[model samples]
Target: MLVNMKKILEIAEAEGYAIPCINTPNEETVRAVIGAAEELNTPIIIDHAQVHDSLIPIERIGPIMLKYAKEARVPVCVHLDHGSDYEFVMRAVKVGFPSIMYDCSALPFEENVEKVAQFVKFAHAAGITVEAELGIMASTDEDTHDDDPEKRVLTNEDIREFFTEPAEAKEFAERTKCDALAVCFGTMHGIYAEPPVLDIDRVKELREAIPDDTRIVMHGASGVEFDQVQNAITAGCSKVNYYSYMAKATTKFVADKVAETDGKIAYHELQEAAYEFMKGYAKDVIKAFKNGK
Candidate 1:
């Protein structure tokens, strides 16, 4: 069933589990995530990032996602993830995404909060839930491996000054009135070069400081282990965003299948194999995120 993102996250928060938020750019991935969620009987988030807009334009993809959500037995929320472009985010809201994540964390603190506040007002008026990030997350992806300093691991001083402070997070939430808040405690985008050291303690603090009903989102969670993810959920992460793992799973499946076929496999069969692999990956991830619920 199609459901509000805030309601789904609230349920996860109450149940002490994190809902898997998958960035899906096509129908295959969309079906994979939703199908796994239905089998698991857990709520799921289907997210579309701004960078992927060209590949799966909102005009075409939005209704397809809404249709999938409506057909699914389990709850599904169509969400726009990391929507840095104001016009594009508004377009997503207009296209009927239940949730929209406005990523303005790169801006000055006050400016970020102010801009989010403005968008939150507009989104809420349209009966759409809003998500905003406070701390800047580091990236290690192909597009930003070398140039972006924010992509590096969070230093001790960075944690204190750059990442979301519990007190400041409370203020930001209260002021922005966002339904969800994405925090950068100690995770980066893309595959990790070293083991990630998450600030589970800070997650606990943020949970205590923020409203109990407000959803706490953790981005850059793709490569983290299940145990660490469990700890984050225990601490208060209700929504965990993952992209790299799913992409990797699909890509690897197709590459291996093609090699095995010696270029003789039918294109449709290869696509089916990739889709099935993605579904399998989604099932495992959903189980891990929900602690085998």
Candidate 2:
């Protein structure tokens, strides 16, 4: 069914489980996610972005996602993920995605809030759900550098600065009225060479501090660690994002399957193979849910 994401996520939260916000590029990824959700009989969030569609258009991807979810027995939420551009966010909503995310993490905090507030207005007015980010969640894809001439790691303060108090987040919701919040919790995007660490205690504290109804989202959240995903879910995280790993799994599978010596491939030709890989990974996540809390 074409269900609203806010409702599904809240249901998952209250029911003592988290909805997997799986990244999808094409039909195979969607199918994989849906297959996993259906097997688990759990809610699923299928997320996409313009950055992702650098090859596959969102317009083509949207209907395919909606169709797969509608056909599935479990609930599904097709969400926009890390939307770097405003136009793509609007386009995703227009294309019938139930939820959209505005990633202003690159902008200064004040500017991020202002920009997110404006986007929230447009999204909420259209009866679509909006997700806003606070705190800097660095990823290899975006800004992550050192001061001077050395590479450095982000500190706890840097992570904390990206977050607003639960009250402030609630007020932002009241003012901009975003439907959900994505906070920085020490996880970086792309891949983590030294392992991704999420402050579970801080997450619990933040969750306790937020408004009861506000959904907490985690971005730069992929290649989910077994313990962290479960712990975050226990700590009031409703939506858990998975981007790089799943896409990586899919892309790698497709490349490995291409036996052509010419190193040439067509889109759909590879997408089919990629979809098979995505399905297996999606299934792995669902099975993880089954085995885990």
Candidate 3:
């Protein structure tokens, strides 16, 4: 069934698990992610990143995502990931996204709170679930990061500077009334320069401090070890955004399959194989975040 993020995340929080929110920028990914959720009989969130707009505009993919969500055996939430621009976020709302991440973390704390608070009012009135970011999430993905080499190689200590303060998280959640708040602890997006170490204690602190209605969220979970990821879920994160590593793994899988087949596989066959691979990959992610629930 198609549902808003708040509905699923509420259950996740109560049940001691985190829902895996994956980026599905194309039809194959949409099918694979939903397929995985159905197979596991678990709720899943499939998001279209604003950054992937050039690859496939929300206008073109929004309905497709909603259609699949409505038809899926398990609940699925179609969300807008990192919708930094007001206009772009409105576009997702117009396209009928049930959930959206209105990221204003780059702005000053007061400005970020003001912007999200205003949007939350409008969003809640329309039954849309709003997600806001409290801290700037670091990125190692070349596409999302600066070209400066120094910026990409972040140590554990470097990431600590971006960690969300529990008291600040409480204030942000209370003021904005967001359904979910993404906070930085230790993970960075894309392939990790070094294995990411999650601040599990921070997650617990944030959970305790933030409003009960506002679920804690962890972004850049892709490269982190599954054990650490699950620990975070147990500590408090109810929504985990993962994708970078999964996408890269899929690419390598397709390449290896082509080589194994000596390039004799038909193009459609290759696509189908890739889709199958991703379905299984997504299942593993869902199970891991479930934290044995």
Candidate 4:
């Protein structure tokens, strides 16, 4: 079913595990994620980012993502991830991305919130859900990886100003009326050691501070202590974003498959394996969110 991001998050919260929001670099990758989601019999997220070449031309990926959501037997949400570009964001709304992440975390506090408020208006009017970011999370710029992930931390002092404080998050929600909030608390965009010691208690507190039904999103969410799948769900992270890992994992899977088959791997066979691997990953992740876990 083609549900909104809010519906998916509700499913996650009620089910006790965050839904896997996989990033697909291309058509094959898209198929791999959705295929896995369907095979696992769980709802999933298709995340799109303009800055990532793997996700250029939202015009191309948007419609295709929507199509897959419609075709899939399980629930799915098409999300525009971390795009600060106004024109591109508007375009995505027109093209119909059910959810959007306006990454103004890099901007000044007031400016970021102002811009988010403005866009929230635009998105809500269109019946599209908006996800606004706060507190910059650090990651390898690919240009700057001196090996210390600590170098990328958004100032702890600045974290409060950059994003809505837990008390203020509710007001921001009421004023901007955003459907979801992506708050930062020591997560990095790329691989980092030990998952940066998550303030899971803070997350729990924030969860209580927000509107009971409002969705909570966590970005830069890969590379953690426990499985990324399990930890987020337990922390009450409703919508978890996974990008770098999914694309890289897909590439690695293909490369290894080709090597193992001695270049004799057929196209369908490779995709089939990729799909199966992802499905198992999704199933394992969903299990973490299950009540017994």
Error of 3 at 11 (Å): 1.4
Clashing pairs in 4: none
Stretches of candidate 2 off by over 4 Å are 142-170, 251-274, 289-293
Worst 10 residues of 4 by lDDT: 155-164
- Model 1 superposed RMSD (Cα): 2.2
> Please, what are the lDDT tens digits per residue for candidate 1 over residues 172-270?
998999999999787778777677778899999999998865688998888888798889988999999988977986787788888898989999888
Q: In model 3, where do residues sit more than 4 Å from their true spots?
A: none
lDDT of 3: 0.93
Q: How well does candidate 3 match the true structure in TM-score terms? A: 0.98
Q: Rate the local accuracy (lDDT) of all candidates.
A: 0.85, 0.72, 0.93, 0.71
Candidate 3 per-residue lDDT, tens place, 28-106, comes to 9999999999999999999999999998999999999999999999989999999999999999999999999999999
- Candidate 2 local lDDT, residue 198: 75
Q: Model 4 over residues 10-71: C-alpha lDDT tens digits?
A: 87777777776777656666776777777668888887876763436888778888888889
**After TM-score superposition, what is the CA distance of residue 249 in candidate 3 from its true location, in Å?**
0.9
Global CA lDDT of candidate 2, please? Answer: 0.72
Q: Order the numbered candidates by TM-score, best leading.
A: 3, 1, 4, 2
Ranking by lDDT: 3, 1, 2, 4
Q: Largest TM-score belongs to which candidate?
A: 3
Between candidates 1 and 4, the TM-score winner? 1
Q: Residues 1-293, candidate 2, lDDT per residue (tens digit)?
A: 66767788778676776677877776667787788678767778887766778668888888898888778898888888878788888788778988888887677756777888888777767778888887667555533343432334444444455554565555555565677888766776666656666788778877876776668887766755767777777887777777677777666676677765255777776776666667778777755543354
